[model samples]
Target: MPDCQHGLIADETETDDESIIGDEAHIVARSDDGPRGVSDLTPEDRDKYDNLVLLCRKHHKIVDDQPGFYTVEKLKEIKALHEAWVKESLHLDKEKEKDDLNYASYIDTIAKTFDFDSWDGWTSSLVSHGQPSIRYKKLKELQTIPNFIVSRFWPKRYEELEASIFNLKNVLNDLIKVFYKYADEGAIDKAKETDEDRTIRTRKFYKIDEWNPELYNKLSEKFDYHVSLVEDLALEMTRAANLVIEKIRKYISPKYREEEGKLLMTSGPHMDFSWKTFKVEYKTDEKKENHPYHGLKSFMTERAGRDLHYGEGVDTHYLPKRFEP
Candidate 1:
């Protein structure tokens, strides 16, 4: 097999220099490296993505020198498929890396980010040097290492895992800022309405200003909006945290983490919502059946009404009161 001419597959051959570079093998043929050849590759792509494929000297010449015989499309397709198969077979094995110190440290990178307040932000989307918002920038930094450390490390949940976190961050980031904005400056900018329907629904929740009756009358509908927004933000954020926990559960066995004393984080402030969405009616009905009843088998007490308690058990880790950035 070592004497064979094929670089990828083993075969019977009597060649002395079976795997030697140039004469017996090619990483990517000299001709194919060109734009007009069978394999057009950039430096980074070739270096990082395993864009280069080896071939025996005989096949290398045929692949590179003759574009008609070996097309660029076919080579790219083969290279892509091969890389995928390799990842599917080895790189996605989470159980193999459960006890790996490097990987555990990598997981800590994300877990610790939540511990500190520096990566948090408002949704003003502050930009610097033509870059994305600061929060976006921070989240991006967190994402880049996961794949490099271990490709498809999160397995099937990876897609929604990233998405839910992103959404959760933005939702809370925006709501936190909006809450502060109304506190600092009584009225929101009417022109920058992003979600009018949700805003309308959120309007039924609170009354921040009591002194200015005119402004109160004008924006009374939206007084409780922050409550609804906070509740939704908490719900969405917890859903995201659950996805992360689910992802961790996928690869690492619970017994392993328990044995090793590594805490599998499922409970955090971001994963807890101590608020509720209150449904309010603009007009109070004269009919006692519409109101909440203390005791009776009346239609209002049985089906239409019951006591509403905003959920309890608040955790600040998921939604911190003070954010550094």
Candidate 2:
């Protein structure tokens, strides 16, 4: 199967768009050692077993019609990449810090993508004639990122911010759903009814006055309501992200370790790409293998997502699930 984008599920309406994967033979092509082969082959043959890719109708047509665009090597590589991500062996290392710094990087990407710090701009986008066009762009950016959605990589150690994390995640999911729903239903409905031209009088089934004085007020009220739905959720995500990072800072030691990836963001009227970077650094804790994740029996335990530990034991210690130092 083709990989779904990280941190999200696909909108099911795509199915109705005639985007079905393999409804025809020509729509689904496979590669072999050479054209001479295929007199007979077993299911275990490496060519078929190891290289299968899924594509929608339009894409399959394009790939076949333009062989240069979808070379045999490229198609196989796509399948291989998707397969590699699915084989997650859970190679847990007891020696490492519990928080996945890489996962922190992923969260940081989300914070930046949503324009978390720029509320006024988001407000303008929300109420504009083209409402959601801005947010849709951001959503597409998030989806285009590869392999960033697997929650299993989350450091999974912080317990103090469990409630906050839960609330934030739940709200963000709500916002994403509403984001699409409004775009499809509200956008179309408004466009059809919103034009200023109003003149028609006939009664086959019925004819009605289009000069409704209440249309402006109705649309304005709905816009306000729509903006609030997203605004509240985005603010909550921003708050929860900061809270997770703050918790990590409280427990991080000043003594240094090895370097990890860094985050950089751009802003301002100049839009200088180097405007700012996520300065927080996570270093290796070689001096203390147990400096983090010290006592947890399993990284999968529940205490990581709660504020209280048993009366404190080998498995209970201060940690943040979203990120490490």
Candidate 3:
């Protein structure tokens, strides 16, 4: 048989220090670059081929013979097991939040920030069933009240929170559109179809028109159907971010705008990569200057006047007359 060590055995009678077979065999985990030995293999080891690797005498004996030493496979298995356990535990923890704060926290925070007292009842309803915000009392009330007339301003100021409702409405529209698209393309049938049939039908008969033409037409009349609710939600999210800054400016500090800008910047470009990490991106200057009210800049500027005020005795800060300090 060929020797496991250096190429050819020069002498049969050579001492342990010279004979290659007499040299210790190192055993290690297959994933590791360290030393390991043959005796380290367990009788019940599942991944025999994947769990062990070999090395030179000194390195092999150092790992195999030492009291605290480990084979490469054993170390790798231990590490993998630990990582799996951690992931499973984390998933369980997050699952627990699904029924409580995870679902309600965003709506709750927005309601409280806007001083809408009826958010509690809505939170209770959402925990039982994940319905749209349109079903919530606060949102329903805001919907009936026009943006300009809800509060005390002469021209009727629409707060970021109020405008966010518009965003929510837009989301509702998109979801409805998707619902209609599926309805048109046969979402209802798809819903009722067996998993196998649905898969087959989707591949065979699915199209962007016809599942629910009547419902699509109705939603279009209500919210301009072709416009995506996602776009509306994006605008509202930007508004929400700005409103937060406005509130901070009044009670915290006036320089809060700078901090808010940083926060907005860090959120990154908004794109619906997945439902898991979805966020709305800020609108660009062209969109802002040309269509501020319907886009990002309007969301930010709507709250701009909230932090500054004018009085009769004190010199009134006029936009065209004087620059804001």
| Residue-by-residue lDDT tens digits, candidate 3, 23-133 | 323234332333343345554452454443333455445555662546455556544675687699998767655533432444344445433343223322211111112
Q: TM-score for every candidate vs. truth?
A: 0.30, 0.34, 0.24
Among these predictions, the greatest TM-score belongs to 2
lDDT measured at residue 141 in model 3 versus the true structure, 0 to 100 = 37
The residue-by-residue lDDT of candidate 2 on 235-275, one tens digit each, is 33343444444444443332211132122221222234332
Ranking by TM-score: 2, 1, 3
lDDT by residue for model 1 over 1-325, one digit each (tens)?
1234444544546864343453332234445545333445554454443445555666666666765645555666666776687688786565446434443454566556543222223211221111112233233344454344344243333343344334434434543444343332212333133422222112232354458776766554343333433433333333334344444545443443333322211211222532222222111231222121211112112222312212223323233346213
Question: What lDDT score is found at residue 58 in candidate 3?
Answer: 52
How much does each candidate deviate from the true structure in C-alpha RMSD? Answer: 19.9, 25.3, 23.2
